[model samples]
Target: MKHISIIVPEGQSNLGTVACIVGAYEIFTRANDYWKEKGKKQLLTVELAGVSKNTDFHEGLLTVKPHTHISAIGKTHLILIPSLAHDYQTAVEGNQLLLDWMVKQYKEGAEIASMCSGAFMLASAGLLDGKKCSTHWSAADTFRTLFPKVNLQPDKLITDEKGIYTNGGGYSFLNLVLYLVEKYYDRQTAIFCSKIFQIEIDRQSQSAFIIFTGQKQHGDEMVQQAQAYIESNLHEKISVEELSSRFAVGRRNFDRRFIKATGNTPVEYLQRVKMEAAKKAFETTRKTINEVMYEVGYSDVKAFREVFRKITGMSPLEYRGKYNKEAA
Candidate 1:
């Protein structure tokens, strides 16, 4: 049987962390049970392992006790890092021993998976350097600032590279679990579990769920000005050259600073801002696609549709149909 170790990180647990750990454990163990019920041998040994014996959360209102300490688990076929606390830096810093253990396990041929902000711990351990990863869209800027080497794809629902896997934010970790089930077991098994849990399977992108609030914490006054200008002039056709000139910076220099500060080029940032506004309009008002497009300063319907789909993984009509209740 393949032994799967789900690392219960040593920190206060948030709802996302608790849900991911419990959900993964339940799904995988249930999969094993289903396999056994079919007259087949049990295929997995799932256990909660940790650096410490137990971790408490919600001011000690809740506690998680692991089946074994990491020291006792000599080897594991897979290791899953659950979502971490919101204070990501502290979460990663507090779990040093656990992170080191994960590194050792990976080196010994164990595939590792991280859920949501758990990617922070993996990146902190240097396991995700130069590898493609996905995490909560809200953490994209911070992740990039902390681990610039990791290819962070906040729009993707899941990312698989080498033997490591990562999934996007929140309850979307269920999709990653399904992906793993299919990869480790079979398509039929995965479909069975998905139906049992009532989770939508094969969800490939979390882009539609992302709320783009612009990364302005990098302290670039000029970039902040540029972002403010873009947000303020959403109805105007603003050019990067015009922005650079308004900020009195060279085009190349402006582009470099903007990317460094916001993790997006000038044009990309503008599109995201515009799309966010469009999304809001669709969610709250009875506006037609063309009305919202013109409101956001897109003159070319084809260009607007292409950018919207690229950023949101859905075309304008599709996005509206999904989000707007009153749209005809």
Candidate 2:
């Protein structure tokens, strides 16, 4: 069985642990049917191996044994490092033993991945040199200041350079996991995992931070009113002219202002909101694609499928098949 090792940072923290447990659980559950179909002995196994937090013997969230199966550095197929506490002001004091182990593992061709602040640890390990990576926007400045060699793209949800993958923030970690599942298994498995986890698999292209940040800037009274209107009546026909009329602004002016504030056209923003709502129903409810289409304001099946594919890169039928297979 292929093993994915999630290396917890030196500090006695639970952030990475939380991400690994949830991500691994969803991955296995969704891939269960696929494994059975292929007659594989077992699906991928995830192991969380915590490293020492200095020599002071600081007890961590889980009880530490002197010897738990320390990963065969050269044998692990995938190694993941979730967000860690490292910044310009606070240097991440790492153990030499852990660094050497990681270097040996990388040399053996293990796919290394990081999430959120975890990029800092990977950067310090010399794995991110000359590589474009993403991290939590709040930590972007500090990471750049600390490691000038790593090209940081704070806007991306995640970046994959060769076998090394890094992503920004907590939610983006889910996007990274979905990407991995898609890479290792298939797009269908990733879709199944997203449904099992109640996540919007189609939202892989959208950055949660960017969406929320744009919403903060759109808190203007008129824009807020329009947003409220759209949220309350997502299924209703919402046109630029309708919003302009409701907000008492000229069509051109409202369109320009909304686009400027939200970084997407008014219709695009509305579609994003509607897509999120529809994705929730797709994951949680036993609705047919046509039913979901009409429920999400797309009366035409072709149009709905086209938009869903454009946003998520998967067809509605493929999505349903993945979930249905898992249910079996």
Candidate 3:
């Protein structure tokens, strides 16, 4: 059996971490039982290893015990890093032992997978540098600020690169585990697990579920004004030149500052702002797709639909049908 270590971050606090650990362990071990039922050998041996024998979370509301300490672990086939709750940096910094252990394990030929915000730890270990990784869409701005080298794809539900894997936020880690099952076991086994766990398999994008909120954490006054303008004028065409002039800034400098502050160019930010407004219209109104399209400033049907899908991973009608309670 391949040894699998789920390294619970030492003393890191998070509700999702507990769920990710329990959910992942249950799914993988149940897969092993399925294999034995079919007269095959067990596939994996899972261990909840940590830096110490015991760790507490959430002001000691929950305590986790490691099957093996980081100091005791030799080599393993796979390691999973669980997500954090509120504080990302503190959790990443607190678990220095696991961070070092991850680097050593990968160098010792172990594959790694991080669920949601656990990408912080993996990135901290220097594994995600020059690699495409996914995290919770809500955490994208903070993640980008910390690890500019890692290609952060928050729209993706899962990403696998060079033996490292990442998944988008929340319980979607189930889908990532199912993907791993298909790769490590077989398609049939993966299908069985998906059916057993009720996780959607092969889901490549989280766009349909994303609520497009502009990244505004940076303290750039001019960019904030530009963003507010774009948001307030979602029904009108926003010209970058007009914004720059109104804000008393040059066009070239405006573009550079906007990109640096918001992590999006002027055009992309404007498009996202419009799309978010259009999304609200789709979710709350009885308007037709074209009617909503016109409300969001797109005169051409093709242009509106293309931009809608580019931002939302679905056509206007599809998004409306899926989310608009009245339509449903």
lDDT of each: 0.91, 0.67, 0.88
Candidate 3 residue lDDT tens string, 1-328: 6889997886556778988888888999888889889999888888898877777777888888878887777888999988886688888888898888889889989999999899998997788999999999988999999998999889999998889999999889999989988888899999999998888889999887777788888899889988888888778877889889999999999999998898889998888888988899888889988888788788899999998899888998888988888975
Better of 1 and 3 by lDDT: 1
lDDT of 1 by residue, 1-328 (tens): 7999988887745867878889999999888988888889888899999877777877777788899999999889999999988799998888889888889989999999999999999999999999999999999988999999999989999999989999999999999999999988889899999999999999999999999999988889989988998999999999999999998999999999999999999999999999999999888888888899999999999999999999999998888889877874
Please give the lDDT score at residue 178 for candidate 3: 94
Give the clash count for each candidate: 0, 0, 0
> Which candidate number has the best TM-score?
1
Candidate 1 Cα outliers beyond 4 Å, as residue runs: none
Clashing pairs in 3: none
Off by over 4 Å in 3: 241-252
TM-score of 1: 0.97
User: What lDDT does candidate 1 reach at residue 205?
Assistant: 98
Q: Candidate 3, residue 67: CA error in Å?
A: 1.7
What is the total number of backbone clashes in candidate 3? 0
